[model samples]
Target chain A: DQQVKQNSPSLSVQEGRISILNCDYTNSMFDYFLWYKKYPAEGPTFLISISSIKDKNEDGRFTVFLNKSAKHLSLHIVPSQPGDSAVYFCAADDTANTGNQFYFGTGTSLTVIP
Target chain B: DVKVTQSSRYLVKRTGEKVFLECVQDMDHENMFWYRQDPGLGLRLIYFSYDVKMKEKGDIPEGYSVSREKKERFSLILESASTNQTSMYLCASRRGGSTYGYTFGSGTRLTVV
Candidate 1:
């Protein structure tokens, strides 16, 4: 079973516009959510994260909003740039496990037209 | 910068051949992991080690084994490689406990013919 899902495989946005990527989870035990950005031929880099206690977390141009009631989270990039184009993955931490195993979604590929 | 290094970027092996994928971390992390990334399946953990000489199986550990002889190094072994095993292998390291995220290697693409 897929605990986390990113239904949209790809998304495109115009430069200077907003780019939003959505993710949903079925497991309620997950308390921490993270977004990772991956470039071609490189490993994923951490972008932003939010705890279950917070509804939103922002870092410069990147912001992540979490809704526990919906079991959903989104990553928003304002004034999106060409450099922001890459595969974005949503991951959740399973706190109930001793290893703190992280479950990752299928990932959403984003392309920003500059 | 903290880094996880996988030994090779690409490899080609014949079926039934033994394969070894090596990973090392420079951050002195206490936790290390091995994962396989497929086109549509996302990243699935193969195994992980929280300390030297200790290991645990992840979601898909079949046909795979791991060794962690040193604190900074972890190795994934494929005793008999198969075509279905061809995929991108990633190694990651993180600090022990529940507070940190993982730092990953560039990944090694292995193809079993």
Candidate 2:
């Protein structure tokens, strides 16, 4: 069974509009979450992350919101730029493991139209 | 800056041939991971290591093996290549525990003919 899930396979947004990417987790054991943006032929780059203790974490134009009660998380990119297009992956870590091995979601391809 | 380097950008091997993919990290990360990404299937972890000479099987370790003899390098080996194994392989490394994020390398596109 997939513990971390990103149900949306693709999302598109107009430039200067807000783009929201949603993720859900079934494993309550997960205590940390992260988002990574990947471009073709390259590895995923770290975008933002949040600990289970906090409800939200924001960095510049990127914001990650965690709703513990709903077992859901969402990433919002305000005024989306065309350069923001890529495949975004959501990941969760098992707190007990000191190795930082993560469970990853399928990913969502986001396209920003100019 | 942290950087993970994969040895090959693209490789083509014939069926039944052995293949090797290498990854090196200059960031001195204690943890290294090998993952394969397929179209629509996403990234699936194959193997990982936390320290030198120590390895662990991830979700899908079949037909694959890994070695970490030194702290700076990790190698993934395919005993015998198969067409089904043709996919993009990613290597990543990170500091210990849940505090930091991973630094990944440019993927290697392996095609087994």
Candidate 3:
């Protein structure tokens, strides 16, 4: 069973425009959510994160919004740049478990067209 | 800066051969994980260790095993490589008792022929 899912496989946006990538999860036990960006051959780097207690968190050009009631979350990038083009993955952390296992979505490939 | 290093960026092995993937973290993170990324399937955890010598099976661990002899090093082993096991293997580490995100290595692209 896939607890976390990214419905969209890819998204393309014009540079300087807003890019929104959405994610959904079925498990309510998740308390932390994070977004990671990955280039072609590089590993994923953490972009932003939001706690379930808060509805939103922002870092400069990046922001993450969590809607616990809807079991959904979205990552928004303002003034999207060509450098931001990469595969974005949304992950949920289950801290209740000893392993602190994280569930990741299928990932959305974002393309910033210049 | 904290870093997670994967031994090989790319590897190729014949079917039925044993394969080993090594990972080391400089952050001294207590939690280490091995995940395989496949298209449309996302990142599937193969195994993880929260402490040295202690490991737990993740969502997918049927054909894979792991070893954590030290807090900073984690190894993923394939008993018998199969073509189906070809994927991008990523190693990640996180500090204990932290809800923060994990630091991932560059990832190893393994191909089993």
In model 1, the clashing pairs are: none
Model 3 misplaced regions, further than 4 Å = none
Q: How much is B53 displaced in model 3, in angstroms?
A: 0.9
TM-score of chain A of each: 0.98, 0.97, 0.98
Alpha-carbon lDDT, every model:
0.92, 0.94, 0.94
True-structure lDDT of candidate 3:
0.94
Docking class of 3: high
**What stretches of model 1 exceed 4 Å from their correct place?**
none
Better of 1 and 2 by TM-score: 2
Ranking, DockQ, top scorer first: 3, 2, 1
A1-114 in candidate 3: lDDT tens per residue? 999999999999999999999999999999999999999778999999999889999999999999999999999999899999999999998877667778999999999999
Model 2 agreement with the true structure over B1-113: per-residue lDDT tens digits: 66999999999999999999999999888999999998788899999999999999999999999999999999999999999999999999998864787889999999999
Write one digit per residue (lDDT tens) for candidate 1, span A30-87.
9989998988767888899899989999999999999999999999999899999999
Error of 2 at A74 (Å): 0.5
By TM-score, how accurate is candidate 1? 0.96
TM, every model:
0.96, 0.97, 0.98
Superior candidate under DockQ, 1 versus 2: 2
Clash numbers, per candidate: 0, 0, 0
Report how far off residue B33 is in candidate 3 (Å).
0.3
